[model samples]
Target: MAKEKIVLAYSGGLDTSVILKWLKETYDAEIIAFTADIGQKDELDGLEEKALATGASKIYIDDLRAEFAKDFINPMFQAGALYEGQYLLGTSIARPLIAKRMVEIARAEGATAIAHGATGKGNDQVRFELTAAALAPELSVIAPWRLEQFREEFPGRAEMIAYAEKHNIPVTASAAKPYSTDRNLLHISFESGMLEDPWFDAAADDNKGMYVLSVAPEDAPDQAEYIELEFAAGDCVAINGTKLSPLEVMETLNEIGGKHGIGRVDMVENRFVGMKSRGVYETPGGTILFTAHRKMESLTMDRDVMHLRDSLITKYASLVYNGFWFAPERLAIQALVSESQKNVSGTVRLKLYKGNVMGAGVKSPVSLYNPDIATMEADPTKAYDQGDATGFIRLNALRLKVGSGVEQNAKK
Candidate 1:
């Protein structure tokens, strides 16, 4: 009889590394470690050798950078999906794509189960398992952090470190750091550990070392720089008039925006589990995209159409934040969002200075802005209806006037 095989989403991080070894020992199963490279540039270095040495029967490292930026990041950017008006949904967007690939590998390797290192408390458990369920509900999800036996075996990071040392498993286990971070091409997030104290300012001088993508705003260039972004159907396709691939566009914008310290946000957001958590994020390229896209929409979109989309923006953002990427309601909203972008082709010029992103100008072929009709210069050819103001105002104020008269009569 053969041992059962289990596929694990491995990050080569402390938690996943320990989980890889623990799964092998506890289940006596062949554990295959898989890592997705979604533009975590140097993070993928030596991952294969590390996974193999950590008791993985096989190691799979897939470079999904281009696909991740194009299919996942771009669509969320198009929808302007910001969780709680602060987070750019960077980690939220990457999870489903990674889990999708995990299922594909599970089917390929004939694995009966899949596992992840997401703690029982976090939103990732929902993100990872919901994706797995949507794609392959037949495969069992093995979350060690939620398992009582595993929790008792290794109570915390310190216990996991002890277990790893006893088993001669190589690890960089010291005291865990003061923050937890997740990184992809779109953004980098910092939370947990010392960040649990909501009053403790993340911008304090001591925490400067935590930022990876950009420098402090005070250290940014003194002069403002302007950049032009071209969008096709609400997706940014070019920068400064030069057409580039989706990944290239993001990489280019990140370099330019990071140099100027463009995107940095800190907020306490409501978790899907009914608690609030503080997180700091850096989303340079995404910030630029959001500002430019909204500016273009202002010029190209009709007033009512824009209002309708704006009304649903919060709900759309919430759906992504809550890990309902595959839900029917999300799909329906996304359909309307896509339809609204049909005439959203345009170029927006923006000024980036320090930590600020502002629209410099916007122009679109379908722009509804008409300076001629709005101008103060009198033109007899234009149809003017000044005399209709009396009736318009009287009709609008009828109820108010009637209520005022009734109050006066009572007073008399």
Candidate 2:
């Protein structure tokens, strides 16, 4: 009988490389390595050669850059889904897309199972599995980190390195930099290793190597530059009146924003696994998107509808952060969010200087801001309701007056 086949989400990284070899040895199964290109530039280079050398039967690398930027990143930007109010949902957003592709490969290759290198303690395991469940529940999931035998065989990085050495696996990782990182088009995230310390400052001299997309704000340019973003139905469709695709728009803004040190955030966020992890992120394009989208919403969205959506922003963010992207609740919330953006068509002009992103001006054909109704200029012909002020004030003050009277009566 042919050996059972399993598709593994491979990144050519230390963990996945080791996992690829281990899966072949332990399960005696044909391991097919799969990598998704979500704008990790050179990271995919030689990935096929590395995977085949490390015991993979075949290697598949799918370029999902446009799909990632459009379907995943753009929709999250539209909903303003910031995980824990700080993170741009960079890693979180990429997982579902990667998993979706993994399932597709598994079906195409006639594989019985799909595997990932996500650890049991991290939220990525949940994200990958949840997406798999949503997409293809029939395919079995083989998570090595959660397996007792795998955990006992390779207790930590040291054991994995020893195994690789014994098996002649070519791995470039060493003990010098042990922190784990995930990168994509939207942002780069750094966590674990030296970053595990809660009180440690990410800006310390030792941690300077952590940043990838942006420089320190102190090292930014001295001059400010202005950029205008045009939006239609909450999606950024143009830049300074130049029409561009979703991917192109993001690429343009990333270059413009990174040079000015626009979007760098360091925070200790609550992980879905019930632990707090300190992560430093650089999200230049996403920062510009958030700022510009808010400016558009301010002019277009109604006051009460905006407040209602704002009230649910935290809940929606929590769901995404916790790896519930495919859940029904998230879909319902997304529908409501999309409905609120029907009239959110406008252009937002912003000034970027030394990490500051400020709204310079905003305009829209469907704007609710009326200068005539708000102007203080006197007009005798206008049907002003000055006489209704007495009743309005009395009605509004009734509760406060009743409370005060109750207090007085109690004192007497």
> Each candidate's root-mean-square deviation in Å?
2.2, 2.0
User: Which tens-of-lDDT digit does each residue in 1-412 have in candidate 1?
Assistant: 8888999999987889999998998999999999999988888888988899889999889989899988888777767787777888988999988999999999999999999999898889998998899889999999999999999988877888887788667667644467888989888999988889989888778877788888788889999999999988888889999998889988998888888887899999898877888999998988888889989888888789788888887898888777878778888988888888889998999999998998899998888887766667874547556677799999999999999999999999
Taking all chains together, the TM-score of candidate 1 against the true structure is: 0.94
- Model 2 TM: 0.95
Name the lDDT value of residue 314 in candidate 1.
89
In model 2, the runs with Cα more than 4 Å from the true position are 379-390, 403-412
Error of 1 at 389 (Å): 5.2
Kindly report which residue stretches of model 1 are placed more than 4 angstroms away from their true locations once superposed. 379-412
User: For candidate 1, what is the lDDT?
Assistant: 0.87
Tens digits of per-residue lDDT for model 2 on 1-412? 9998999999998789999998998899999999999888888888998999999999989888899988988878778777777888889889998999999999999999999999988899999999999999999999999999999998877888888888888888676766777888888888888778877788776666667787676777998898999999989999988999888887888888888887888898888889877898889988999999989999999999999888888888887777788889989988999899899998999998989899999999999987655567864446456678799999999999999999999999
